[model samples]
Target: MAGGRAPRVLILLCILHLHCLQGAKILTISFVGGSHYLLMDDISQILQDNGHDVRMFYQGYQNMQGYEKTSVPYAVSTYNMEEKYLKAYDELFHEYQREIFISRDRPQSLFPLMTLYAKHCRLYMNQTDILDFLKQENYDIAIVDPFNPCHFLIVEKLGIPYIAFFAGPFSYSLGNGLPSPPSYVPMYLSGFTDRMNFLERVINTFMYLGSYMVEIRNEEIFSGVIEEHFPPDSRPTLSDLYNKAELWIYNMDFSIEFPRPLLPHIQCISGLRAKPPKSLSQDLEDFIAESGDSGFILVTLGPIISAVYRMDFIKEMNSAFASVPQKIIWQFKVSQWPKDLKPAPNLRLLDWVNQNDLLGHPKIRLLVAHGGLNGLTEAVYHGVPVLGIPLFADQPDNIVRIKAKHMGEYIPFYEIKSDKFANMIQKLIKDKSYKMAAMKQSVIMRSRPFPPDQQLLGWVEHIIRSGGGGHLRPYSYQQPWYQQLLLDVILFIFSCVALLIYIIVKVIRFLIHLLYSRKKQKQN
Candidate 1:
């Protein structure tokens, strides 16, 4: 009996230990462009390395080193190339892009594109082949970037846990309030700026108002697509979509982000940047060594912003580099440099370059960029001050925040003249404020209690440790903006005060009239 009891206890202990080991199949869908995949790849790699199985879905290849990737079932090729819908999509994309470039504050402008993107994502999710694959694979949780909101919704509908990877500084991760960052007014305690100048607060309020409207419209558009594709019974209401979000891993650091509101289910695990390769190419090494100590500025507009679109700016940049003592390293994808433009002694241009490693080096002094979130992260990670030449989309918002933090300077893409560019570079290079601000942010980023990659793993594993989507519910989106702000209470009190004033005035008039009449009669 004693020997049997000892064996039973040992078996029970083993079972408990096995139960504690959290190993689940994580399905990730990354259907956006190269920059979006940067965020996706980081999270997926972290999960896979931490004893979890990951199946990654991708539309395009950006980071192609050594990661397992499964192609999205139907990408751009499968779509019927009907002129009307294609034109409609193109027009919408252009309009949105234009709005992002010129608008003073347009946080919700991306919703229209997001809805169109969601429609295509749903189209792919509908195919019979995908249905078959879905039925065969057993997944525990599906982590998707919010840009591909439909896939996450599908995971939620399946009663599996789903998480969103925030690619930039958007408030979508802050809950169902809106897709923009928290109101830029009164500056959240942990915001990048110390105080909102009058103009900035006004702009922030406009953004808040605009974001509310956009979220309402996006919900309608998002729900309509689901209703059109899936049966009424199969789809969840907009409320259900936000509620199913088990965790949101933000690719932002607290130093750069405003103070976050409480959403117990939401988790912030930002600064998950891709690490640079161990060594640099010979050409790059030679260029770094030849710069003669003063170092250089790395100018890039990322992979999406074609050099052709930015050729004029490059001309200005070339003119600017002519005067500066510092050398310049440009990540040029195009083959042709303008005929009139002569390559300077201190200038070098490469088709493709390692941006992160370049920024990390002690030789690189300033970064002139298009202000994509990835580039911003890199500049901050290396404590390099920047001159933001924002193009479109979130670039404007990113630059504004970048400028607000005093970490860099910003110039509109079209307005960058050679003289202006050169002068700006000279100011940034000579001034210590910009460098100090960047270094401060970098320290804050590094000082986080846990590494961002590890933090992401912990939050993901926590979701698995708990049950999937069961912990988070969808009641947060129920109230409208007016009600949430208690505008009704203000209206009610104002109405009561007005009514009381009217009643008092009427009573006083009546009393005066009666007294006048009585006095007149007595005199008569």
Candidate 2:
């Protein structure tokens, strides 16, 4: 009886072992902006909660403090960009910001800055310690933020299947080979809506082509970096690695994003970061209570922007806030406040605030933001209208979408006159339409088929269980450019028709000539 029981126990142990092995070992790569890190952290958290073993490799220039309490195991590498590269980056960032404010168009030259970042990422990945650690780790799948193309190569070198994780709306590079006709699906940086006139469509088409060319150039830059870090003979090309991705998870939703075609493997986990409103701090609560029926406004430009340094902008904002009846909570990051610049008595300045929590508060009437994706999503989640002060990158496009939805209005930084700013704020607060539209979008955004976390985890598990879901990848991705566009087929059909018409004309000419010759002979 003891021996029979031991045999049954062994069978039970084997079953337990199989169940444990079913849990995937996931590796996540995140870099650069705070927003990107936040999105990746959310994903890592969900993956780990579902019993998978998740590890992350994070490298960023700033905002490392945000991930201090994360449970997922991680190896962090900082570029130490502050020591040497900060000045250059600051100059570029502000310059680009100014350009966007003035022109409200895509920056003329982003390739230089892109290549600079690529070089830094390549340098970090080539470190002996990082390389060895990554090589030893056994991972079933890699979820990468493809903001830097170098990450794709890193996953490829480790011989793991990967999924592209974008922190914002699907851009041109990520949406490549996916059907996003420019006529309807606006270009990433074009700042156009889905509803476009003929001129806008023509511009969208050109912008699409231009963006593609830039991607090609950047790919070439990344290819050289790959060759330097890995063996040239056996390594795959950048395009090959890009096409090899098993899935794509975009931090976007149809509610806030333009409708476009997408592959089955692509998923949208838009408001995953949004949570139920938490109780405000004692001081915050007191401030809101003091405001009474007037409510309060929240102003933040996010992590990268140096809003404190822009004295002129600050003065204009101060003037505008002074005229308003509502109290204000401004997240300004300066050590010493300028004595000469007097803010409104109703304004309260702090170094940081829990933006999501503040947005959810019932007493908070308006959000003044840099039009970042995370901020916009949070505002939409809480049904709060925004007064957009767009600076650069996707900010313009975000504001355009807000206006189209009638959820808000935007004032470019360069055009921020005190009266105009004040009036916009007043319009947002007094008008019920903006609030109604925001609530409508919030409803749509929250009405996902499944909770965002569950959706994210389910898709990730699907990829691992299905062995990278290679069958879901579009065949068009593997085809030549002409063939994928059907230009070759169109050309073939046109040639055949032209040849048939030519042959008919020749036959008719010959018959007419013969008849004319016979008639002349009969006359003779």
Candidate 3:
């Protein structure tokens, strides 16, 4: 394996070296937390590894796990947010997540999240010193996490080109002018399959319209920040700034996701951070060995959702894991675990897990996840089936795709019980079909003509070399909705046809009246 990889490694370096300038300074922004920042961190590291002077600006709401300046190869700068914003974020999300989402009827969550991100935009713009420092960096281009529009606002202020980095399935491209036909394409968080029935299609259409409504609300949320920071005449509209991205790098792959139309400017670099399994620690290895032929299950509900893990939920999961023969390696922090409940005999709970590396283990039978894109992508790369218990945001929507692909099944959090949860786990592990499906998806994932890193390095350098990706973007981006969809032209044709028919009918009636009058006079 090492021998075969050497040539490909050298070729990749040569390809990247061709575009390598005298160390082009690249700036990356991460305004959101969790997997969003993780994706940017990996991207920044890749660029730095390829000899670019990469720097990451990290700030997040309420200091969630994975929000800290993680150990990465690139330089990182930090900005502290005010206590008021942190307090507000805590009060809002904790209550909302517990009360609304925990109820599990798919309540409206877009507006609340948007409102929080908008507040962060205001907070980000208030950092005059950071803005001035960024202006002096003179970066060739910036990579913005479009999750928070403020990330782009900073890049716009610096007056450099930027690429939008989407962390997948949150439907950022829809409002940013991707051609999403509602008939078959499902909206983010709608939880409908790509192949939809008539009722599903109707709901999908409304969900598409709801996306526009969300965008409008998002604009309203951020209008204050733009007004306060940018000058009147020089102010940029939200749509223009969103569409201004030279390229879009999505954390999505067609193998796991439904096939959809994408532009040349858009690229999928899913599972770019994945690596083969490393040797497990002695204790963990011993535990896996005890499971013997059954292997083990890896479970993580993400950092945010795990913090809210209820004791009853943990007990139920524990009972289910006990019922299974497969040893469970669950990523549960011991500090937050309830004193009343003990872990099952077959399970081992760890505070921190090397998830990607663990997924690639030789004996990894299944992954039990919260359906986050990062985890799911790793599962796809490792050819491991998943049993998703989705909670909030894109989690539910993501699991829908997972189940649709036949790699795994999902049990709604509110509906999870010991019996049903154990059955699903056994089905995913015992059934060879799910494993076969997962391996097939992995083949598709790895079958891309060029690896994701090459695609990233290649496209990023091409964009910088050409100053921007404006040439790659289609001309349809500049057209208004009426012209782009040809709605006005259709209306014009319809009206003209109607008018011609009306005129023809009127002419025929008049001729018939004249003929009748002539016939009456002759008869008299």
Candidate 4:
């Protein structure tokens, strides 16, 4: 009877543990871009596969028809504000392109562009219908891309813990209260590596501070919007709310990124978008096979900037491609080819191509890209050298890192003469060192103990099981900025040093006076 009872007790405990691991209601939010949406979709699918109920709220101009194919349900809200933002983005892209190529000094201030994005996010959240839907969901957790603080407000209103899903390298703002000394870690968008000279450090520090200032300004703007939507008592500052995230999953790998200290709550989830190379269409396969000894080059500017380049620039690129001996596969935006410009028989232009699939091909020699993170990761994964033509955002930084690693070179768009472009392409193709370095980095990137997707799923499930994983958050999160920076300690030390100096000076003066008095008395 006793043995039977023990077995029953064990079985009952097992049942309880299974029940505890049941599905959770997850809410995901992100701004609408192909790369952003794809990342969020991957996250949602992973959670849903594990028996979690996942829903998404996205804002942007891109069509959401792609979501229909996914099992996870999502809602997209686009207002007239998207058109305004798109127009602004187009103008900014052109301006940035010109600044990168034509001007000696590129504009340092990204505050205005960041502010515009913040306003667009606010507009999306302020919609009554969107807010109502979010409220109705009764979500258990909110996973948000912290590009803007507006999602923090949404999660606060929903009354649930949220996670920060960084789509790029770990952001400095996300490391608030944590020990990320700028002495080593490069500031986002600074394009400097960890190794820096005195001047570079000064510039890096200024850029770091500037980014924080921008964040603070946006926070104030967002705070007013949050206050308007919620009761005064319930209104939470964006800074306070942002730090409340239970976990931070940054799309960074230490192998690729500079070494930096991270709190326990932060996890690196880089290369989640990477997957096994898929089969290319028969035509593409045949094209690569026909490339013969001199392999092909793949060129793409990613999805957003496909239409941003001017025709004259496109013509110049075409001319450069004509000069190169290697076969070229260029992903251009327009279907109609330019009538006047003639390309070499080896050049092929297409509207779209399976980028990863092409990179993984043995006949492919190099990649010419805009340095988007996804494209960079693919090139690195396949061990292909790159010639980056960076435009804006993280592109410049990404290219700088690639060059630092000796994996590629970049050509400024304004300097895109046919001879120079052809020579650069030829150099990358002929140089075995670039290919070797890329292959070495590829080993490091792929050496993780587990697959990236599995690692992500495991951490996410851990968070869900532990109910927001609050214990993982560091004590630093609650500390004041001065405390976090040890500024108070520095001030105390400075005061002590000043007091010691004063006492030493006073004693010296008294001794001098005593000696002078003695000397005068003797003389009398």
Write model 4 residue lDDT over 336-408, tens digit each, in one string. 5566667667888777777888898888899999887878888888889999988776778788888988989
lDDT of each residue in 319-392, candidate 2, tens digit only: 99999999999877554456788768999987777889999998989999988898899999999999998776
Candidates in order: C-alpha RMSD to true structure? 6.1, 4.2, 5.9, 4.1
lDDT of 3 at 338: 78
Q: Enumerate residue pairs that collide in model 1.
A: none
Shift in Å, residue 409, candidate 4:
1.4
Misplaced by over 4 Å in model 3 are 1-22, 60-70, 105-107, 506-524
lDDT score, candidate 2, position 137:
72
Sort by TM-score, best first: what order?
3, 2, 4, 1
| TM-score comparison, 2 vs 4, better candidate | 2
Off by over 4 Å in 4: 1-22, 63-112, 173-175, 336-339, 491-524
Off by over 4 Å in 2: 1-22, 64-82, 85-108, 173-175, 304-308, 521-524
Q: What's the best-to-worst order under lDDT? A: 3, 2, 4, 1
lDDT score of residue 173 within candidate 3: 66
| TM-score leader | 3
**Model 2, residue 179: displacement in angstroms?**
2.1
Q: What is the lDDT of residue 412 in candidate 4?
A: 74
Whole-model lDDT values for every prediction: 0.68, 0.78, 0.83, 0.75
| Candidate 4 worst ten-residue window by lDDT | 62-71
Pairs in clash, predicted candidate 4: none
lDDT of 3 by residue, 234-281 (tens): 988788898899998888888878888888888888887776778889
